[model samples]
Target chain A: MGTFHDDKGELHGITVVVETTGPRTYIGRCFEETEQGIVLLDVDFHDPAEHDKTKDEYLQHAVKFGQWKKLAKFVVPNDEVAKVQRLAELAP
Target chain B: MPYDPEMVRPMREELSSAGVQELTTIEEVDASFAQSGTQLLVINSVCGCAAGGARPGVLLALKHSVQPDRATTVFAGQDLDAVNAARAKMADFPPSSPCLALFKDGEVVHFVPRHMIEGRDAQSIAFDLVEAFDKHCVAAS
Candidate 1:
């Protein structure tokens, strides 16, 4: 766990994924982290609802540029997180 | 012990209406856990956040080109045994309702917890699921 925070600290300016208790997923720049959870600077959120598949997956594109109609800052509780992974470490 | 079924009917319907099968008993969970295939077990909730994002996001992700072989759901605060059984399969993950459990060959591969759903948008949630499906679902390969 000690090494984990150090690794996360290095990602302060980089992108990361926060997986929370609802099993929800959020992607954004690593703003800051605490004992509770990480605060994502410009997060793009995920949920399980139905929408048009034919439409372009604009959100994925939004993630890279940090564009989305969402709350600018997301504070994730450590207790609610299942895990956190750097975007670069995840499969494309 | 179980929740008043009538009180949780709408929340159950939200996902059931979205084609998510409800898991009420531990036996059903045990059976599902034994099956081989990519399985998505969503721990459903009554929170406004879930209604706004998690549920909608998940349903959208399932619409992708590839998805889990079976998608099931357990209602938090309602189906006690089923939720517990599902969490038991999750290894050490702390219990969080409105979680997304992605399983591969009966092993918990990816899990999404409630804190993740709190303030995220539907599209963001959808993107995560699509990526998970691509990387974890055998059918996607």
Candidate 2:
């Protein structure tokens, strides 16, 4: 069976935060969606254990000021992702 | 994929030799940023184009009398986890390697992104950082 994902979804070409089941959280530009995973460019990968601030606090900051890009590219596997939300959605 | 560590060793050492702590793991990055006071984090990259200016410039900037409490670096491609963690701390700016950020009490006070370093000479880049140091850093006793 092929992986089913929207090619024309609002997530493409926009800044998003992809939270994984594990400790990792990624914020970046959604480049594309492939069967393997969601391709992100200019990514900022965050491991909650490595940070002093809570994930929600960090997201709140991003919603206000925006996030810096770290990795040139990253691919998050579909099964590994717990939730995917637009960075703007988290804004008030 | 990350670059070959062996290949980037010299590039990494250029900054490390200047008394800048090299953070190669997430834990190390977190620990470095967790401290109180001003900190300087350099997102080192293997791009000779920009890094040529960034590396030497950072070294030169440290010579200024006013300096941050600590200086640290993480290689962009060769140290993915470490670089990512470092960038997370600098979430307010657009991500760019060969970048410099000054944090005062864990808040970003100044940032120099790739575009600012790309065509600039080492002396010019150093001037930019030195100016930021003058504005944001304190002279150590």
Candidate 3:
């Protein structure tokens, strides 16, 4: 039987949260979705709370705030992702 | 490992100065989140989405009444090893800095990736985290 997921097809151009293996999550619109993997455009990264209290006391004492251009795209290996959640629609 | 520490120090500080811990090595990352309880992982990055959205949101979230028992960070390009190790704990999640995760008993229960960060402003993102913190990071008796 084919493992093609029809729901992925419906998410084209829609904003989504790609939750993958490592339980990592990516936010973007699906550029391509096949049985192999998924592609995203205008990617941004995410982080959750964890430990680093000691590290912060050291490194944080020194850091810079220069601006950075956002990454334009990214792709996720099929095996890495767990599921994709659709987010609220953006203003057209 | 990728960017010069001097170059990105300020951006990294934006988070640390706010009381978020920084994990620079694999071991450090491992030990930090190894504990069992509620934790918040803030993936620090130098991208626009981070500066314009994630950073501000996280700092604002800190001001809320309820918050995580612990909060920490790993820079994407600069702290590659630490970031990789931290993400590894997230179980198969793709690598994205400027990300946020909320862990319950060491398992990631809530997350805010870049897609969620890029579109919203600092206030909106903070509102989201505040809501999450209120829901999950309440102080223990």
TM-score of each: 0.59, 0.62, 0.63
Which lDDT tens digits does candidate 3 get at residues A1-92? 10133465665544566766673456665667877788777664343333333322311211111112245777888888887765433211
Q: Where does model 3 exceed 4 Å of error?
A: A1-92
Better of 2 and 3 by DockQ: 2
Candidate 3 local Cα displacement, residue B124, angstroms: 0.9
Tens digit per residue, CA lDDT, model 2, A41-90 = 88877777888888888877665555666788999999998888777566
Off by over 4 Å in 1: A1-92
Query: Between candidates 1 and 3, which one is better according to TM-score?
Result: 3
DockQ ranking, high to low: 2, 3, 1
| Cα lDDT of model 1 by residue, A4-87, tens digit | 233555555445777677835777667678786788875667664543421125344332223342567888888888777765
Which candidate model has the greater lDDT, 1 or 3?
1
**DockQ score of each predicted structure, in the order shown:** 0.03, 0.09, 0.04
Which rank order by lDDT, best down to worst? 2, 1, 3
Error of 2 at B92 (Å): 2.0
Error of 2 at A88 (Å): 28
DockQ of predicted candidate 2: 0.09
In model 2, which regions exceed 4 Å deviation?
A1-92
lDDT of 2 at A34: 78
